[model samples]
Target chain A: MLLIRAIVRPEKKDEVLAELSSAGFNAATMVDVVGRGKQKGIRIGGMVYDEIPKTLILMVIPDDAKETVITMILSIAKTGTGGTFGDGKIFVSPVDEVYTISKGTAGL
Target chain B: MKEIMAVVRMKKTGATKKALVAAGVAGFTAVKVMGRGNLVTDPKAIEACKEKLLSMGMDEFSESWDTEKMVTSFLDGSRFFPRRLFTILVHDDDVPRVIEAIVTANKTEYGIGDGTIFVLPVSDAVRVRTGEAGEAAIW
Candidate 1:
């Protein structure tokens, strides 16, 4: 299994989630977080707000399904032509084990 | 690549960020989280509970009642404390530097709830805009 963590703008969270659900990858955990990327947060007026609100979406999928899920998220989360800063980045990690708490069954 | 996750005191987030930047880290993600360490009966923990109860209209108990006992009873109900979890991804060579920076900024003389640093192995990373992967994507 692979764990995909996508940090996207709050405005695009719903769209990304909906897209993933439509694609049959429904199980996901979303957390509201504050972070920054290469842009190092945005500056408005005379102040620099270093912490930007974002939605972190986490999902665990079969290894083979990684590309499809990532593509779906990227397509839905990107902003404007060629994408702008804060469009978000995705990190993929290996998941050694998964268990269904209610069913008492293992694997996803 | 490695993912360095550091859970530090809420008040030390600013110092941690500055330390990471000074250590040459480009970007990071931070989330507000609530967690508890092994020291369940720490005095500071009990004091925090008392303060919380007093703030929530339990001032009557503060003067006449055994506040410590009340706080200790409440401890079983609420043991978690607020913390900041910083998730930073850095190249393999930079792991030690990042770890050092986080520790330097968060460590205190008390040494109990200084927080934890976890270094996890990242399989891959992707930059959504340019379709880059691996090291090319992580910069």
Candidate 2:
């Protein structure tokens, strides 16, 4: 199994989630977080906000489905004509185990 | 590349951040989380608690230490403590330094719930706007 964690702008969260759901990935956990990327945080007017609000979407999927899901999120989460600095980043890591609480069973 | 996850006490987050930066780490993400350790269910933990209480001069409470009451109260949700989960991505070689920094900042004398650190292999990383991959994407 593989764990995909995508940090995207809050405004694009729903669109990304909806697209993933339609693509048959129904299980995901989302958290509201404050972070900054390589560009640091944004500066508006004379104010500089070091931590910007973003949504973190976590999903555990089969190894084979990694590319498909990543591509889906990349396409839906990007902003503007080409892409902007805060388009967001994705991190892929390995998953050793998973368990279902109510069923008391293991595996996805 | 490797992803280093550290769950530390909430109050220690600032010290952790400074430690990471001083260790040359570029960036990381942190989220507030609520969790509990095995303290409530472990017999050894209960004994340790009793010892600490006695050392603090709470002789009555320590002498009357009721395991059943303690377990019930903890299970009722009073056991959950706030923590900060930091997700850090670093080059393979930087793993030790990052882990060292996190441990130094979070470790306490009590050492029970200081938290846990996990190192997972990262398959890949991508910079969305620039389309950079691997090391190019991370640094």
Candidate 2 scores an iRMS of: 10.4
Residue-wise C-alpha lDDT for candidate 1, range B1-139, written one tens digit per residue: 9887666778999999999999999699998865443334456745664677756645554653566565654453234467787888889899777777777777765445566665668889999999999987778
**Candidate 2 lDDT, B2-118, residue by residue in tens:** 887666778999999999999999699998865443323345544665555445554454544564455444432235466687888899889877877777787776535666665
Which runs in model 2 stand beyond 4 Å of their true positions? A1-108, B39-78
lDDT of 2 at B74: 44
Error of 1 at B112 (Å): 1.5
RMSD of 1: 12.3
Per-candidate DockQ values are 0.04, 0.05
